[model samples]
Target: MELKTLSEIDIISASTSKINQVDFENLTFGNVFTDHMLVCDFENGAWQKPVIKPYEPFMIDPSAKVFHYGQAIFEGMKAYKDTHDDVWLFRPDENFHRFNKSASRMAMPEVPEDVFMGGLHKLLEIEKNWVKKGKGNTLYIRPFMIATGHGVIAAPSSEYRFMIILSPARAYYSGEVKVIIAEHFSRAANGGIGAAKAAGNYSAQFYPTKLANEKGFQQIIWTDDATHTKLEEAGTMNVFFRINDTLFTAPTSERILDGVTRKSVIELAKRENINVEVRSVLVDELIAAAKDGSLKEIFGAGTAAVINPIVGFSYKDTYYELPKIENSMALEIKEKLTNIQYKLAEDTFGWTVKI
Candidate 1:
């Protein structure tokens, strides 16, 4: 596929604006969307000219391969508005590279950088007003591709549709989170599509998460599938465990998704002279730490929540509550990262990109 220029994209302005109808002060995460969206079709072994048009549903065949074989992938990102009214993206290139990596894992075509990043730039420029200026206020970016080839056969699709949509979002979670450790359910196995951002990977977790939710837990800390002994992820995000001041998180493998926020957190912690170890924390080890006074904190990192501190965790019907502390490393790191995202503090790592 040949790379194309941004000027080739077709633009169609919306007939009317819905900005006035929305109440920015109060928003449900991922419920509302901007007026315009970016779309590009893939066929004949090549990506077509991209289009930026009004946000609305488009028809698809009932037997599309995505409905059968699940040839789909997506990426989560955000656009933030600074005090100067400039829109910015945090580690967008990382998302772009990971998006293609997921595409390859799912047997889908890779989208060109121009179609992905350029289209995003053009789309956000039109919807700049949708990005609210303040900490915790952002325009959630959802870029996804799905199999569009019409067939019920169990195979990869010949056609695909790539799209980018924007949604105004506040905080993802409000209350303290309690998690249950997985014993039977497995999120991914060896040589599975667990590391990819494929749609099925998320769908596979719904049933187990629903079960956990029924038991009065907000999420589940998934363990390794083979033995269900090593802590891998919390809900849909990468998890970290702070044992007596040293941060420990499982290294990314075939079973764990390499989260951008997770990497950022590790780097930021190191920069702040905090000890961070990239190694798997065994379930037994964690239980021992919890029994003693070593286990101080457990948190999840991802693009959505940034950092979600776990109040406690349940393992083998035993609940272990984390002690309340005045100056928490999780809160401190979250504040520093969010400040960088909102441009309130100096971005010493050169992670933020202006648009």
Candidate 2:
């Protein structure tokens, strides 16, 4: 794979004439997609030519490594349009950095910085119309890497493919999620691939999450594998607990994904002079706080929902409900972050990237 200059790649402006005729007013997450996509392949130890073409399905070999071994990793982000029709990405560099991190964990080739940014920018240019212009409307971008080599050796593939797809998303509202605290099933263990956004990490949770869903729970709040005393993260998002106006969240470790939104929220909390504690939060401590009325609120942070407040949680047949406030720290920080994303507020942290 000989590297080529960004101008040399044949970027076809072609897009699908027919789209998902669904009403954008009411859309599900990741169900519909835009017309164009960005794709690149890795061979000979380097990235090949990148191209933007119409979104369409392509054939994969029956023995593709990603199919049998689940050698895939992905990142989620959004592009927002301000009131002036300007588009922006919130902390895109972080996502790029983490994408490589996931690639490394999955034994996939790392996508170069210039190649990733260049491909994303070029793709966005072709699909700009897909990005809606409103407070909660934006284009949800999914960048993924998969092992495409067709082999059944149960080892890393020599070839890989990196692609980006866009989906028009409405404001995601889980509506005060009710979570189930895990005491037996663990999402990821120490010295494992939990910190990475590997495809297997998500697929492994389907069964346990399905059980929780049957019990009238939306998601799972995973705990440490050894002890199950310390809280870790949720199925997709990082967890946070607000105790008496003080914000506390578990620090990123080998058992948690170093989420971009989680880090941004930590910064925004400090900027607002909100006391934040980035340490190991014990599940028992939170239960005690809830019993004593110190647990004000609980929320999850991620790029999908931005910030989803957990109204309550259950553990070992015990349920705990959180109090509702007119103005919550979760809501406040979410608005601040989104405002900066849409260029509606001052970008003191320089998180937004103009396209």
C-alpha lDDT score of every prediction, in listed order = 0.93, 0.87
User: Which candidate's lDDT is highest?
Assistant: 1
Global lDDT of model 1? 0.93
lDDT measured at residue 102 in model 1 versus the true structure, 0 to 100: 99
Quick one: RMSD of model 1?
2.0
lDDT of 2 by residue, 125-219 (tens): 77777777888888999999989998899999998989999998975654658999999999998999999999999988999999998988989
State residue 253's C-alpha deviation in candidate 2, in Å: 0.7
Per-model TM values vs. the true structure: 0.98, 0.96
lDDT of 1 by residue, 1-355 (tens): 2222488899999999999999998998889999999999999999999999999999999999998888899999999999999999999999999999999999999999999998998899999999999898999999999999998878889999999999999988778899999999988989999899999998898999999889889899999998998999874679999999999999999899999999999999999999999999999999999999899999999998889999999998999999998889999999999999999999999999888
